[model samples]
Target: MTAKYPNKEHVTYATFLSSNRREKVDGVEIGTQFTKVVVNHPLQENEELVRPMKHCKTIGDVHSEGTSIAWPSICIQKING
Candidate 1:
């Protein structure tokens, strides 16, 4: 998704299933779920946004082939888990 900043900066995201109960995909849930997204020591000049409360995306402004709750490729489209 192209962001409204600059001429045109497509702000893609790395989706993930962090404790969020999304639809059953093809992979199994692993490790610990994500809770808080820690910010740098000094706030950078970048916009940090979670896709949505339902389907949460990890970091914005990234470019990937998209993921799911199965693969857990860094994956969530459901509400609370």
Candidate 2:
């Protein structure tokens, strides 16, 4: 591997969703994964997204590990308690 990438530090990797393999017992999968350091913005045609953005909200909106940010795009009603 060193021969192919002697200076790997110079490599600027973009969002890639190739860490996990596509495996489905019945072809139904959903939810988000905060474990990935790099998340593919525009999912490819042949790629499978195990996690969906909608499910993330129900799970505390954890887009990534060690970080938590409010989803401003959602229409949240401000009800005074």
Candidate 3:
């Protein structure tokens, strides 16, 4: 299967579910149907890199209304490299 975020730096197991659909397997809900099957390539060590964003802080006076800041966006990278 193709990676979810192909342009991304890392490859993860969850990436396989990108273009998949929901289905029921043996009365249990599972992944998508077999649209196509592709051979899984051998994963290399340190083949992929994921640079995740860490903590972020805003410098301002807490009691000052105008000096405060809003919430920031967070990106968490799950590495399977």
Candidate 4:
């Protein structure tokens, strides 16, 4: 997928499934399964810093307008072992 910035700069992202498995059923209980994926060349700090305004492109302007915005990208990703 390609992400286009407000300045018209495009960034390509490639995702790969590192590992995946089906859930196994034990007796009458059902187990949960998950897939582990890795995104090649994920965005870095420098990239964000260089384009801080790019981050706000989606929400447009928010100058004390009392408008609520949802920024899913800002959510933190948790790693499990």
Taking all chains together, each candidate's TM-score versus the true structure is 0.18, 0.18, 0.17, 0.19
The digit string of per-residue lDDT tens for model 1 on 1-81 reads 223222234333223334445333333323343322222121222433333223433332222223332222232223254
* lDDT, model 4: 0.26
Q: Once model 2 is optimally superposed onto the true structure by TM-score, how far is the C-alpha of residue 7 displaced, in angstroms?
A: 47
lDDT per residue as tens, model 2, 1-81: 001122222111123222232322123221232222232122222222233343342222232322222211111122244
Per model, state how many residue pairs clash.
4, 2, 0, 0
Off by over 4 Å in 3: 1-4, 8-20, 24-39, 43-81
| Most TM-score-accurate candidate | 4
TM-score of 4: 0.19
Higher-TM-score candidate of 1 and 4: 4
2 against 3, candidate with superior TM-score: 2
Ranking of all candidate structures by their lDDT, best first = 1, 4, 2, 3
**Candidate closest to the true structure, highest lDDT:** 1
- The C-alpha stretches of model 1 lying farther than 4 A from their native spots are 1-12, 15-17, 20-25, 33-81
